[model samples]
Target: MESMMSFASDLKSVSPLTSGCALIGGVVVLLFIKKVAISAYKTFLRPAIDFTKLGKWAVVTGATDGIGKAYAFELAKRGVNVVIISRTESKLEAVKKEIDDKKYGVEVKYVVCDYGKFDTKARDMIAKELEGLEIGVLINNVGASYRYPRYFHELPKEEIQHLLTMNVDSTVWMTEMVLKGMVERKKGAIVNLSSAAARYTQPLLAEYGACKSFIEKFSCSLNAEYSGKGITCQCQAPFFVATKLAKMRKSWSVPTPEEYCAQGIKWIGYPDDIVSPFWIHATAGWVLLTIPQALTTAHFTQVLGGLRKRGIAKDANGGVSPQKTKKN
Candidate 1:
């Protein structure tokens, strides 16, 4: 019995030592992971554009209302000449007139083009319009979600095509076109507006979220590729920005348009860190690190679906609901 007690005590002592080593090892691993995450955040999340380093002109697409118009106004306030591109020339003209009336000492120009229905001619036209202009900043802010919330098969074929064209094709084409001049000069800032929907599992907005996911991933990869050079490519993904589009989504928490624009410009002009004001919503990077990409993608699809349903049902009146207006 005495020998048995001695062996039991020895086993207990050995078990504690083993547990202690394991605890220490776990802590070290966590610290290493934290270090890696911080390094990545600094490397990719940082903004590349320095407004003070900006040249003569800036181009803003979809610069008629909401977030795009706000970006134009902010740039104008900084005395940078702006070229506004949108489908509605009248709206562009109105914006120009307002800027001129403000006497902000910035020139405003407009290009009437629908990015959703892009063609070779439209691309050439934009290229011609941009010729000889030193464009220091390019804001790819034109994107659209479906008019009605539905599953993939339930959505109209035309609407799907339109969304894909506007959200993915036009954005990629515009970046590619503008990048020619920027790469030649080796100095330019490209700001692509992405979305938090990219991270969440949203079933109803599967395509929209997927497109945003593409933008986020593409921007990060592009930044890695071009950071060695002078050009900086930054993607700004905000949550529930208080734009005309968000206004239609009754359940969304709309951050003020002015605030969104300010944050976006700050990121575009001087991205040395993540530009998102609502960093709490940065689940994409976290999930990508913690879980498998496929799993995270699946989760985001489901989350987005719920959001889409809420967005559609909450504001079915076609007018800005009281809840949305109040939130804005």
Candidate 2:
């Protein structure tokens, strides 16, 4: 009778612990399921907003070669006229010609104002060029990053200036210029290009990542402030797309600009203020969020450190360095 009583008491004590663990596990599973379902719905089920209904024209910055160019083409295909801006007038002209040749039934124009300058003069010129137009969408896609990962101290004065002005200043100024018009019209969409660097800690690419983070936050706040007025502001955070800036080959994770923009276009004007539109990138982003920040930061430190070593070695050997990421 004594042994039986002791066993019963132990069983009773263990039951609560077991039940508690089970409840915790059940909650975790439920949360995971909810996240998966939401992701699936956004990626496959949500209908894409027809951006043309917002206005007749979309302005895309850095629209010569990479994701910006792809966005310009995509908007044109959707029956919206495009205005492409870039530092290189020649490249901009070429892109305009290519779009025109496609006969997408939308006018294409080019602006040769360098966001690197990011000055009042440049802004005035752009303002003059865009006067008397119903500008609906603004793709704040112009940004700069280091050619390869390097310590902040070693970054040149010019490079630092470019990073701040091109990435941060340009987005702020461009939005300021067009925001009033959109507010008056009471309908517009703005897509600001951020990067995976912003979402996670980046060691060697510190300034670049910080600039992108600023963009993400700025975009979200803009969305909050303007959505009630019929304007939607979004930050599109991409991981890696094969482009001159990224210097990576296309793959499942590193998509071509076309592949990225194809999915990315759907998210614009949607309720989400910040999104990694590509499904794989979105999944990776979620995983990063689940992991410890220390782990991610250390991983970036090691990887970028290795890259810095190789870049320095190539320079010493008189080999061609990776091209500087002038625009993205």
> Where does candidate 1 have its weakest 10-residue lDDT segment?
272-281
- Residue pairs clashing in model 2 are none
In candidate 2, residue 162 scores what lDDT? 90
- Cα RMSD of all models vs. native, in order, equals 6.6, 5.0
Query: lDDT by residue for model 1 over 183-282, one digit each (tens)?
Result: 7877878888888777655567778888988887877778777777677778877777766787544233455667667656656744332345444334
Write one digit per residue (lDDT tens) for candidate 2, span 211-273: 999999999999999989999999999999999999899987999999999999989888699
Which ranges of candidate 1 are over 4 A from the true structure?
A: 1-52, 248-253, 269-275, 279-328
lDDT of 1 at 205: 74
For all candidates in order, the CA lDDT equals 0.76, 0.92
For model 1 the TM-score comes to 0.75
Best candidate according to lDDT: 2
